[model samples]
Target: MSDTTTTVDRAKRGRSGSVILTDRRCGKRVANRTKIYDRRCPGLYVSIIPAGVATLSFKFTDPGTGKQRSTTLGIFNPETFTVEHARSRVYALKALDPAALVNQLR
Candidate 1:
């Protein structure tokens, strides 16, 4: 088919979608989801999925291996777990040693 499929816009917060009459060149992968970045917290973002559920993730560099890694902090809850809390969690994880961080991964 000439038309690829549906397109979704994940820019900014809240929900956004539209019927984009896009004519893209063939043979390229299309992204269906997007991440909501936290301005105050680096590496912390809300991962949006096609199932309409968003989760919190913390990306960091492994101190022991020096390799980049990511871990799920928790579910993204505006009331209980805010961006500030996510930032604090990032700080806490940074303060911990690699071994401890592995054990403390949630």
Candidate 2:
């Protein structure tokens, strides 16, 4: 038998560190934007689109299928979102049951 496993970033694997404003801004300006997960909060990340639009997102694993799942929290822009707000959102989302979340997807 063969085994296959997909691992996310080390920081995302567990509580690693907190995300700062500079990190988020840099991600938005990068040519090839990728997900920048908050080390202090598991499953919380910022996704910067090609046009420099940054969005707050949450990632979690579904217990039933053992697969990763994600959802958008809000937009991370100067007039709208902030790191504190994002952290609070993450706290709220973390309290939800994974199974319930999966069912909602269906």
Candidate 3:
């Protein structure tokens, strides 16, 4: 997704890298105008939405087309979810058989 934040700053600070995100780091990045990808999680990202509500999302290569795509996993709810929980979801998604995932959806 695009944002009003300049590319220069993002590039200098890095739009993506190796730093692990803590709860506070997640909060800070969530406020940024661009989606903040977690270096530790290949397909996981925090979408740049309104402050106080960070949306956890995942990106994957579409098997059929071999193209990258993204989808929302859920929003961060401290009482119900946290960074570790979200990362676990990403791992779960990665571990699931694609066909099984589709069947579950049905």
Please, what are the lDDT tens digits per residue for candidate 2 over residues 1-106? 9999987777444322445534445344645556666777777778776787778877888789898888787887665677668878778766768676766545
Best candidate, lDDT: 3
User: Worst ten-residue run, lDDT, model 3?
Assistant: 97-106
Clashing pairs in 1: none
Candidate RMSDs in Å, in order, are 11.9, 8.7, 7.9
Cα-based lDDT at residue 67, candidate 1:
91
* Position 81, candidate 2: lDDT: 76
- lDDT measured at residue 45 in model 3 versus the true structure, 0 to 100: 82
- What is candidate 3's lDDT per residue for 1-106, written digit by digit as tens? 7767645564767465545755676565444555677888888887655565678878887565577777778777667767789899889878888756444333
lDDT of 1: 0.60
Candidate 1 least-lDDT 10 residues: 19-28
TM-score on alpha carbons, each prediction: 0.56, 0.64, 0.69
Which scores greater on TM-score, model 2 or model 3? 3
TM-score for candidate 3, please give it: 0.69
